[model samples]
Target chain A: MDLSTLSLGQYTFVQNAFSFGLAVMAAATLFLWFSRSHVAPAYRMAITISGLVTAIAAYHYLQIMLSWEAAFSAVGGTLEVTGYPFNQAYRYVDWLLTVPLLLVELILVMRLSKSETVSKSVTLGGAAALMIVLGYPGEVSEDAGTRFTFWVLSMIPFIYIVYQLVVGLKGSISKQPENVRGLINGAATLVVVSWLFYPLVYLFPLIGLTGGAAVTAVEVGYTIADIVAKAVFGILILTIAMRKSEAEGNS
Target chain B: MDLSTLSLGQYTFVQNAFSFGLAVMAAATLFLWFSRSHVAPAYRMAITISGLVTAIAAYHYLQIMLSWEAAFSAVGGTLEVTGYPFNQAYRYVDWLLTVPLLLVELILVMRLSKSETVSKSVTLGGAAALMIVLGYPGEVSEDAGTRFTFWVLSMIPFIYIVYQLVVGLKGSISKQPENVRGLINGAATLVVVSWLFYPLVYLFPLIGLTGGAAVTAVEVGYTIADIVAKAVFGILILTIAMRKSEAEGNS
Candidate 1:
């Protein structure tokens, strides 16, 4: 059956799913906001970070809807672009948002261990830089000029972040609470999982693993990894929030 | 672009990815085992459940390798049959493993709150039954007749588990320790996130979302969600394990 000939009911169903996803995001955002004031300062920051991500995801979905219109117009009389700028704006905004979130989370975890202030700032800064390099340009762009330049520039910080995490984990291994240690280790595993596919994705094309569907499969795999990372990271932050409050009450 | 024409190197790379995945599963199993002796008896059971899941995943990977000869032969044969039996077996085993792990984690959290036994067992048993109903026949046949019958049967248990969780949450909402409560809530959310797409996946075909690729996309989406659930649940289990150990030490 031709997808293009989708019945009205089918179209409505897909549209409704997308709409429901948007509503869920909005609700999550509000929930984060409401809980923000009650949490410790560090957790409040994490909630703020989560709120930003939810907002970006909502915007991304809206932009996807606009891209549909752009595609339709591109096929007809005159080409019209409805959401390119908004889409492109969020591309970098998403990276900026995630980078700080990752860095802040790492720092907060370290601080919970009562690590040296100087070392924590340096480590957090390094992680932030790494996130910028790896996550920049987003993963969807096909423009060679943009993709290649950003890809090259992004590796510097990515390597640095990996180095810092390894060093930090080694140094702080003895000091961390068991739960925090487990979370850090799990998050590190997820980061490695995400990065392991990067070369296979971007570099494989240059080495001839570039068939159309194969490339599509790689992208889908990366997206799946990203989603897993986000979900795990969200749980980690929630744990931090709850644990911090427990500690406070006992004190 | 025919996949069959791929040289030895490409095939080896793909095989290596699967092997790497298997290795990760092995590591996860080891982690689960180590966790078992560190938590309370109730929480230890949860960790054991996770270990059981890891074992199933390991077995699934081994099955894939064992079925490789048939899989490769089928690729070259006139019949379009892939070694989908092995694939389906892995998928169902993974789901069954996940459902129990999720329920056990929730039960451990609830146990921390009120020490209620009968209600927790009923809820967990209901969840296990639902998982078995959905998972068993879903793995056995791809034939429409079997698929339709199993899908309907699966829904009965799925709905029941959801109802159980909702009621359980309401009952324990005010009494739970903040940390344990957060963990339970997060676990419930993860379960919802993992299963949210089920209806989309099963009902879509009835609504005319056919074709191999479309079906594969939905399957992959579910697989990714499963990974996310495992990662988040792993963190939650670790949190409880650590707290249980700490409480034991204090006593």
Candidate 2:
């Protein structure tokens, strides 16, 4: 919400977070791509989509790193704004594209009956997009009232996604091979927990946090959550796909 | 080797070339990754490595882009040097890494006997690396003697690789499934022609070409060669893999 001079330590913290995000997302994308043939044909598209999500994330992370460098110059003891506004919109743009695909990839890998897959994909994908779109205005707003309003608006879709993951996906996940049921449940939990971290980070400025502290908090926080949500979640999806492929004697 | 003010048209030509290189590499990486599952498991590594080669190229192209933008300022009718050096090393570094893997991936997908695969991969991979390493001296050196000396040395491994692709691989190509034999032959031819483009481009500075025209010529020329070598060559690998998979009844 406001610019503050950053101590070198504070600037490096966010810089490392974004650079690490790029590396992890890129590595995960390739690993998923290379491992795609290990899954059954029915679930291969899910693995492909997982790779797509991470590749998209990797591209954004690269842009984020550039924007971070452009916005701050830590020349001596402190990091000062270079008057190039940090393109924080890269994060929202990434989320808008990937969040829906994340939901779709999970649904696809479950190998749900066609009608159910199509229905759930549409519903959850729409909710994810809505959540991101509603959150952006709030994310960029400086006024506490406007920010809080969009936060509340955004939470509506967030809760819906959570509900779908916890309740609606329960039966489908149950229908997964017995060996992967626990992993599936863990993945669903991961999605909820990691996704939840974003809103908490979003509220940092609204709380007492401000200036470098608030900016660093949100940057580092959101970067960590994104890595977990995409990289970790993609790994879980790949593992489940492999295990299910084996369970089905397709491996 | 010397800086000159560039007309806006000259600057945009090179800038667009680097940007296009970045986009093409990124797209090729994703395409190869998503198509990996379409091939039989035995051939999937070739497809996976194709993704990797393109991905590595993409990363360097991103860096090259940053350096290109940083090295020039075209605020008016002319583009002027910005005191930052254009990171031409990124291109050589990329070539060093991907060139070896490009050879190895081809050897791998041929499904030679284990011993033959190992032998060819080692020899060809080593040759590719040496070619790039040898070429870099000439690539960066402005001295005519130094550049010409390295050029001749680099061509040693280049000719070796082309020989292996043509002579040594003839039997291997003939042994391949009939459905993919034509494709294999074409791939070998593609490698030779594309790689030949590099040395010609490398000679640009050695010739009468100078200043921005020389820079633009080499940048655009090398960018085209790289795309054809990695992206087009990679597509051939994937097509061969898919055809071989189908012929083997493994698809």
Candidate 3:
């Protein structure tokens, strides 16, 4: 987004979101990492992956926040673009690495057949990677046609991923322990809904929003999604692990 | 991940990742071999496997770095992809040898019953070798369908190995002296998590990252995973061996 100018409120709103996103990620990383012992050994890898996702997200949010502060000069009453350019690659890079892993952790926790887990993880992970990588060009493009074209390209994989998450994983989630069955569904739905939210935020600029408002909507919208997809969703995954761990007779 | 368009920054990122990876492996090899005397005689083989894993990884990193330099020309102000096809086979070859040893080291250090050790080692190591062998065809394939097919083939062994590491090893880890159990879990998680990361990075090219970006992601991503899975993981194993030795009353 081309943020030529911003009011103090808009600037701070994004800043707050970034800070909050960073905090959520940091907290989630520690929570998941240290709690590894609480779960049975079989489920540790899944929870560990959830910790990894947040740890990487925490790093990106930190860098993105610094970039946000650098690009906008808010020291004085004037809010103007600075000589330093903001790097948007951090968000895409984070998504590229973490999105696939998110699917992986979910698949790992399900305790599916070895072949099925392998099959689902590779297919779903590859699709998630495709969706993130495809979205990057359109995200950085200034032209409407370019943005719209890439959006459609990225959506192809996005649809595939969501279908797999919902329909493909339906049977697996049902086979989970009775206690975590609802939470597992919640986790899957949370992933789909949060992922769906990302494209809408990507469309803020294409859908008539421009300038500072577009920038704010896109940034804030993404922060909310980031928190939901990584941290809140991670906590949900962790809770499922804990429940399954308890069911298996572990304290 | 074929080398093509590259900015100076992207070129350097891969170069730097290679160099750092090389340094870690080289350092790890020396550290493991020299430190081997500190562990009990029974655990020495485990530490020896650590050295072997890092030593093999180090050689590959050196070759990989050289290939990377040969594949790209950045002597002048202009940066360009050059004639040399960066030999990625070095990685597969390295993994083919060391991956089996990775599991062998873990199993040996656990000090399992000789019969159980032989059985688990043969099974896990064979699976590891099969995983790497199955993965190479897909790695070299240009078609997405071919890559996906081989990825599925490889995941079959990957899932079996993970099961052995998690469920199969759970009872064994619990039987270990308290000090090194956490370290063992860390090592296992590191292997699984890093191994999982490699597949997703392999998908980068197939997904949408083309030309320079795909090459950059694959190169840097693999380098990072290599350091973690081989060198860093080797050290973790070494530490566990030392702790176990001490717990056995060896200074």
**lDDT of residue B177 for candidate 1:** 56
Give the alpha carbon lDDT tens digit for every residue of B1-251 in model 1: 11343333233223333433343354455556645555666567667766666567656655654553244332221223343333445556566655665676666645643546556756676666575667466445646677677777777777777776766566765475554666666667777667767655766555566554454455445544544566446646666565655655631
Q: Chain B of model 1: TM-score?
A: 0.71
The estimated TM-scores of all candidates read 0.49, 0.55, 0.58
Q: Is the docking of candidate 1 incorrect, acceptable, medium or high quality?
A: incorrect
Candidate 3 C-alpha lDDT tens digits along B117-227: 999999999999999999999999888999989999999999998888878899999998898889989888888899999778767767787877777877888887887
Interface RMSD of 3: 9.8
Ranking by lDDT: 2, 3, 1
> At residue A108, what lDDT does model 3 achieve?
84
What is each predicted model's overall lDDT from 0 to 1? 0.53, 0.85, 0.82
**Please, what are the lDDT tens digits per residue for candidate 3 over residues A35-141?**
87788766876877788788778867887897689777877687877644465667886787689889988898888897898799889999998998889778767
Give one digit per residue, the lDDT tens place, for model 2 in B1-251. 56565667877888899899999999999999889778888888788888888988888888778777877777865667765456576677678668988887788789999789879988999999899889877866768999999999999999999999999899888888888888889988999999889888788777778777777878888899999999999999998888888988998
Candidate 1 C-alpha lDDT tens digits along A105-181: 54554454434644665566656656554544434355556666666677666676667666656666547666566
**Lowest lDDT 10-residue stretch of candidate 2 chain A:** A71-80
Ranking by TM-score: 3, 2, 1
Off by over 4 Å in 1: A1-150, A153-251, B1-21, B37-42, B64-70, B73-86, B112-115, B134-146, B208-212, B244-251
User: Residue B88 in model 1: shift from native, Å?
Assistant: 0.9
lDDT of 2 by residue, A35-56 (tens): 8878899889999999999999
| lDDT at A118, model 3 | 74
The full ranking of all candidates by DockQ, starting with the best, is 2, 3, 1
Give iRMSD, candidate 1.
17.3
